[model samples]
Target: MTSTTERPEVEPARGGTHASGEPADDLLARHRAVAPSWTSLYYEEPLELVSGSGNRVTDSRGRTYLDFFGGILTNMVGYDLPALREAVTKQISRGVVHTSTLYLLRSQVELAEKIARLSKIPDAKVFLTSSGTEANEAALLLAMTYRRSNQVLALRNSYHGRSFATVGITGNRSWSASSFSPLQTTYLQGGYRFRSSFRGMDDDAYVDACVADLRELLAVATAGDVACLIAEPVQGVGGFAVPPDRLLGAYKEVLDETGTLFISDEVQTGWGRTGETFFGIEASGVVPDMLTFAKGLAGGYAIGGVVARGDVMDCLDANGISTFGGNPVATVAANAVLDHVLDHDLQHNAARLGALLKDGLGAAAQRLDLVAEVRGKGLMIGLELVGADGYAPHPAAAAAVLEQARAGGLLIGKGGLHGNVIRIAPPLTLTEDEAREGLGVLLTALEAVDAAQG
Candidate 1:
């Protein structure tokens, strides 16, 4: 294992000049000049990651860190897996990368079939897209067309995607840039339990309260012709918030009565990231009308899609095509990733390593008062930081911890409505030793932050 102490402290370049003639500062300045202002970045001095192998990534400054964030949980099987590389290489050799949806690609058909088999939705059919946002957009379109209503329900503190339509359903104000959307969205309150109105209630009571609230919300907020209730089984960018197991099942019961669809946004929680099951919604014991997936499915390849019942999927009368959706390269890569995940049983690995990581994080939280909670399932875990009051969010502390952790050779992530949660979602292939190493670094960082505040 590489130690941060051994790494050289190369001073950041000013303007467009650096010792190696590749100035990160200049690149960042150019990025800022062109990219949207709302684009968030991590660290006091943001890193320019150059290369990665397995669970470790090296920065432009030649500093190596154990990548617990997994490129925001997109590197599901880990970086640069031999099998994935070989599959992509073979596809590249074929000299056909993009075939749009107009052509019938063998890889695309095989992948769609594989996804349908794994989706758990009966008579499942899939529509591929380029990202999670597009997948959610497609699912929304299907729901609206099938139910013939624009009214939709979403959980509070939820993040669906960044597209115009998805932003409307996204309950987090920080992520949702605008209220201008065609869909009439009503936010529900059960997806997050920590800062909920039913915070003091037991699990059963919490589920019941949320269910009752949903029923009341539908009665008062909607015209009884609701389209769908889109939700993340384990809220991702909303700080890995896992609602009660029965929450979605209860919501589904209400939706069933109203002929409303249930669309599970499994972009983050899919492909065994949640452990014990292939999809996070399985824990809720509900098979959704539509399931959207992205991120880890293609092992870093850009691919997203929606799996729905045959009738629901075929609801759209107008012809549509995704220019890069289910392209030869991405589909082949996705198929390879799925095969590798199943062959090695990474889901079981996620379950085992997740338990170890959660225990380590819980122990660290016990020693640090700033850590308000450590929650999540499988490889997707979050540590929420609090202020001296012990309950109020402490974004500064979280930031400090993040910086310190990076300096100590660990790369994690941050999320939450208040940006006070440390998100630790390593690849499902994370070993016990790596988990312990990461936990030790995180604990040290937390201690440092606590001491600095004192």
Candidate 2:
């Protein structure tokens, strides 16, 4: 006897409407219902991006905007590069997406060799991971184990990543969710200058003051056995806060005396984004003990790694493995990205276009009271929003500008401890035309924000 058991009707997938002609609103409603509360969304009405090509992305409603954020600086060569696509396709045909680090992978070895050659670290060795956070974790582990200390020093208003360990090192309070951490971290001064008490000082005095502060922090805040001092040459999430070009070199002097490892968090500032140097720390004329990188190297694929002095890298005695680290597909994508970055000389383009963008942004700042300062190097620029008081951070103005820019068919990013700085980091492949268009839209947005505030 065949029993007819009726199955209950299944609801549409959470965060998405059913195929029964439901509108996109249902998808958003579902999203709110199922997504984590801390998952932040941009704009008052969050956009649903569906497609992208080159430097532009299309929203669910079919409106296209020039993507200046580059998916938070991860899309190094821009979206859907023909060469990268071809490489990824070829890798996919190989029938192996992932192989645990237990086995050898040809692409991983080639990518590591290329990065080691380019890293500039003496006798460099590379270890791959799935993201910047993991790379930093590895770096921290290597440093602590090598030096046999859990004490670390980081810069104020700096951001590393969101992992438990990385967040412990992050000085940005907004991004840090918990105070509890395994490593004891000491916060130092130097990364953020605009809001510093030493802002009135000349460049030389400022550098000396920052170094003195670092020295004090190391002496007072940390025990005698500090393991490492990690810093972002250009603090990415801290609104691209850039100190004097020689700041890290100055800090390295003190670190050397203490036998502390210096780890440069180049996750955002690597791969020639800064134009003047392939790695941002190179501008300081100091070679870091270890360098952590991610984002741009993989051309939108998940890949991160640490390049360290061979001796330091070998200090980790125990077994460590990242299941998806150095996966075949990601390595291929990264290798292709490196080729494109070098072949096209994107770094030089970044330097050339960055100057034009900065000039335009400076003009906008001069015209608009809302724009307090324009700072950053190469293609990574930041505009700090301020109120009529001239020095007070204007987060509302920043929000207004973001919305205005999006409405004007431009997409950008925001950061800073107070969330008042506009982060404009387009892909390295950004052209003169695209830069001009983005600048025009940004200026218009600034004007709109000023009018709104008034």
Candidate 3:
């Protein structure tokens, strides 16, 4: 890496203006100087996106790329959306902007109502937080208290968050910060069959085996006093690994008898990203006891929350609050996002365009041996890269295609248990033309990697 003062030689961005502007690396160098070493960034040469509109973002170097990853699936509708900006600015303009949840906030209440209606949890009660990690922590607080148990269940290859408690439950060791957790967490088999014991089984058989395994684990591993079973319907950071249909429903069957709560972490798969339904868990045919949401919920706002029934949510016999959770501006922004998503029927857009993209990528996997699997639904898709033998994970190939896609004016994401899965999740407002353009660039990138690595 170049020292902070050394300006590396740079190349111009294609189809970009002012490409020779002051070195874009300066900001990154400054960030490295102050930010924690563990705070990671994307790409070989880190990109500083200065502005965005619709489904694209322009870097400080003046290069633009179709934003397929949507800022890790946070920019739901797109960047610089007029409606969201207006609502947020209007909220900001109103007086002191007092945000602590200690006081009653009309905007916060309204947003909670919308989420309660949308979350699909029976008799849902909402609690807002600043991020998905905190939202999940809140869920854990409720579940563990309600059930009077600290034992929790999660899936293999899962990633909940980096917070202390969440890190304990996270099965993806790559994202774990520490091994210690207050809650007793157990890992169960899910639909990420590539690295699973039920790899070759059909969907029905796979679900059966996983459910059986879970029952046995709970019996042998614990005293049958589990608090909750939390999962991502579509494993987002785990490379968009979609569990088999009815898998969660089957697990819910066992949890029902054990009095164990079910929490669906929708941080990455919420807001129509999966296309099949509004919430990713809806497709699984199991209504969760609690749902944790963040990322794209309020467009680009830093907001997340949990929803559960009144009895479960009120189990804590103490008062609590968040300094910024459900703040006026973010909540109003989320209300606007909900309005936009509902009025424009953007979920249908995600369905239509997402289907097109998935079909195209599926076709690419047909002839490309490097692509071991094409899984996930709608816009939340994954391409699992493999080595020459077509089974071992090829993280190098994933990295090469990521760089190639950036060069081709497309920005995507990479994640998996082994970092070999290419994640594709675009904005819900993406047009058909934009969708086709991004698909073309991705296909070209895949072809380039296939030729070099196959």
Candidate 4:
């Protein structure tokens, strides 16, 4: 007799058909009718996820996948945990679901305190927002205003967010939606080197070269009239491109000399997902003057936040308020997430399991030439697919692997400028057996695609 949570991947006990019982094609058609054309979705036949438990999610068609992507690294604690559900339900029962930021909310204040303490910035001040875009928007405002410059510097192959402001700073053209940017953005080299002139150089040498380039670019491009240098320690949407250790530190040295600010966008890489440290940027030994977070921080609640040096955050003279920034329910959930992460020491789990998963993928990449590189720290891993020629990006291989993994009951994600890097960041609560199972499915899918392509 198996437990209720236990279900075969082929035959989920519940959630087989859409609530409306509409055909899958009709459902997609209905979505297309209401949604914008540019809204990206996964798969040839997009999966309609209905319910989840632990690391597995059941689709509308009664199939359960070992969810490796964790809802784009948002579901850090996984789905349908009793502890999480009960806490949220109790909060909802207390009547104040959303009281905005007008009044002092205990949950919100508690969350702020935790984040401030965790944030490396001294005398930190935090502002909550509804999403990463909003959090980053807040950071940008602080930096530009504090420095009184609209000019910003970001790394090539980096993604901040989707807003007009962040899109201006975003260097990835694929994720950049609009041409009109509010900031005069100067793109730098160094984060992604899959096709970089800095390729093949040793790590320290590469960092030195990139720092030198940044100095030259600043001298020539903006002449050091920049407000800040915003970067992700591990380039998340740009395919988990882990810059060499101290890369940002090297950049910070340059920024500090010019009184420029540094902002770390840890939306995907924060909250111990990077394993070795509390934040992904920690591995770089660079404490950003401003830090932005979202995605997995609030246990899947809609929340984003920015932490800044108190003086910088308070520099703005105008009165400002994010109406629904730290809603009560979301803050409660965020508090629970923090407690769980700290109590269980999931950071160590991430490091241990991340090493196991990366070892497996690295071995697969070594054996199968289809995979060009297996890079990333902790659980935020990426497997970059390539053509038979080895360097050319093979997005088709990535696509095939995604579909193949889905059919084989595993859900992974793909990113990168060319969309050729498979992103794998599962929940921090992922079990060892579960990690191995997902890894097996992923390797099989990779091998299947490699053989089919050959």
Candidate 5:
């Protein structure tokens, strides 16, 4: 018998009403006509998510799915949680929706205080934005504005944002340089041991080698020229790669030696997602001068922010400001998310659930020929798929797996430099049983894809 979890919520599989109470093909055709092709990459026919509550989202076709992707890791609180809705409604009724950094807003102050308290960064100051890319853009601008320098160092395969400044710093040539010229920045390759290009490397050796390469880059990079080094603690889009335990300290020392600011882009890794207090520099016991955040901040309530040390933030205070960056409604939603994560001990849950998922995925990968490896911690996970033959991207197969999983009543995501990595970033509220269900669904999906490929 098919597992209950694998059964689609839509009944009579054919001619069924959608979650939006509309025909699925009609909705898909409308979207295909009105939306950009890029958006349609993930939104094929019969795609219409209409409602969400907790970890399940219902589509227009009345198909409910276990949302292991967590709305691309933004819905940390799941969907329509009463607390978040109430917080947003209260803020809206208060009639304080729009405000700039020039004026002090109550929600702004409260959210700032809560973030500082949670992060434990002394004299932490915040800059609010509308999205993670904007947060990264602001961080890069701030770093550039503060430094008496022109050069910045970023790791290869790292994702910062898409704005000109942040895009210049993003290391992926496929996503970045192919469309734009390199800005005033240099790329220093750094990441995990699995398939790392750097040779003669162990954990310590990787750090030492990266540090040496950075020193050389600095020497030729014009002293007082490199402004900052931005990196993710655990690589998310880069195949959920985790660095060696020693890379953080070693790189921080290199920055210290060069008097360069260190920026931690925690947009994808922050909140309770990593089973930590905050996706701050403290994860690796290294303190960054600046940190960028978004995604899980407002629990899918449209908020992003930056936390910087006093000295670094002072630079922004002296030279810059924003409008509508810290709208009261968004901040209130952010406060509610912070409260919910704390009150429910979501961080601990993330840690426990992550362990369960990772172990299960590892075993599944070992039993499956299509899977190359499994990596990630906490709720952030990735499964790298090996090519069936030549070195071509297996996007077709990956899409097949995603489609099969969707049909099986699970919502998953795709990632990696090649789009072949199955990303499993669920809400922090995910339970062990939910993880098991998702894993089983994904395993069955993989088998279907393999069989189709054969």
Candidate 6:
């Protein structure tokens, strides 16, 4: 591990120049002196963010930049939305700042009802938690408790959460290693067309291969004791990686035959961010026994997560109760977020804007040799950067591109097991005009990175 002092701090441009002068050296020094190095892993920007508004953030130097990252794709409605602020303020005025989910909370019930109605799940039940991790944690516990089986099978590259149970089920060994204990769970490799060993196989053959691998894993790894099979409709952190359409159907069929419940972890893609109804699952016409959501639901106002499914939810009682799961204030904020998203038709916006973004990125990939593929659905997009000499993750190139994007007034994220893919998942409310501007900035960043390499 590199020490903070050894970290290279990029200097902002000189004052009076378009970009802020090199980042303040003292600022970076102080961060090294005070903050832990782990937090620095999120970004390597020079300027410190001071405040933010809709789609724009102001740095400490008074220079503003467009926020394309959207707080790692959590702020679906942009930063500090008026309605979200008002909702939070009004709830704070009511004096129920933080209360356990012991008794009835009106906002909690109301938000739950709204989510249930919007989910189109007929009679879905909602369980609120503080973060996506907690939500996934709750879902994992419920699946294990309900089925009376401890073994759960997850995809090879899927990212669930970091909590003990969720981490055990998460396939990414790097981030999930600390929480890796001997849990009654196993991981089966999922389909990734970009790097599949069975690349030359047709779609039908690929689907058959996935089914066969899953059945073998279940028999050997789980000892035929698997309770649930959890997967993301579109793997978010693993890469903006979208699995083959037939893979979902085939996996569902295999799980059905094995009597293992299916769980969809939509924590990142849920709440209309991925267009097609709720998420990619709806597009494939597969209904999971349990669904998890979080990221865009509350629009970055406060953390909120939900698990929807009537029959499956009925399996757990006090075993899954959260102390501060459904606080009134957070619930009120969530209620307003749902109201705004539905009333403004954000799902339709997500679909339209996502197409615009996908087209832009795909065209860029075709024209640029550095780009390997443009994959993902709706607003959730990824651009894979091939290695300088090989197809592995070009971390230095990825870092350079990220810095260039930040300097050019756009923010993007990096993901994939190799951290080679640049992730672009903005708010569902992002306009076409904003998409164009962000894409332009992104293109400029890529050009600059290539130039730097030259």
TM-score of each: 0.95, 0.95, 0.94, 0.95, 0.90, 0.90
Taking the tens digit of each residue's C-alpha lDDT, what string does model 2 give over 1-454?
Answer: 8999899654554454423334445556767878999988889998887778999988876789999999899988888899999999999997989887999999999999999988889999999999999999999999999999999999889888889999999998989999999899998876688898788777788889988988788778877789999999999999988998878899899989978999999999999999899999999999899999999998989999999999999997788877999999999999999999999999898899999999999987887888888999999999989988889999888888899999999999999999999999999999999999999999999998888777
* Model 6, total clashes: 7
Model 2 worst lDDT run, 10 consecutive residues: 13-22
**TM-score winner, 2 or 6:** 2
Once model 6 is optimally superposed onto the true structure by TM-score, how far is the C-alpha of residue 337 displaced, in angstroms? 0.9
Q: Scored by CA lDDT, what does every candidate get?
A: 0.90, 0.90, 0.89, 0.90, 0.78, 0.77
lDDT of 6 by residue, 140-217 (tens): 777877778888888888898877778888887656757555467777667456776766678788778878988777
In candidate 5, clashing pairs total 7
The per-prediction CA RMSD against the true structure, in angstroms, equals 6.9, 2.9, 5.1, 7.1, 7.9, 5.9
Assess candidate 3 and give its lDDT.
Answer: 0.89
Q: 3 or 5, which is superior by TM-score?
A: 3
User: In model 2, what lDDT does residue 428 have?
Assistant: 97
- Stronger candidate by lDDT (3 vs 6): 3
Cα lDDT of model 1 by residue, 1-454, tens digit: 8757667654465665343456546566767877988887898788888788988988777788999998899999888999999999999998988989998899999999999999889999999999999999999999999989999999999998888999999999889888799999999985677888789888889888888898889889888899999999999999999898888998899889978999999999999999979999999999998999999999999999999999999889998888999888899999999999999999999999999989987987897888889999999999889988888999999899999999999999999999999999999888889988998998899999988877
- Supply the TM-score for candidate 5: 0.90
Candidate 3 worst ten-residue window by lDDT? 10-19
| Candidate 5 Cα misplacement greater than 4 A, ranges | 1-18, 22-25, 43-46, 177-182, 221-224, 317-319, 389-393, 451-454
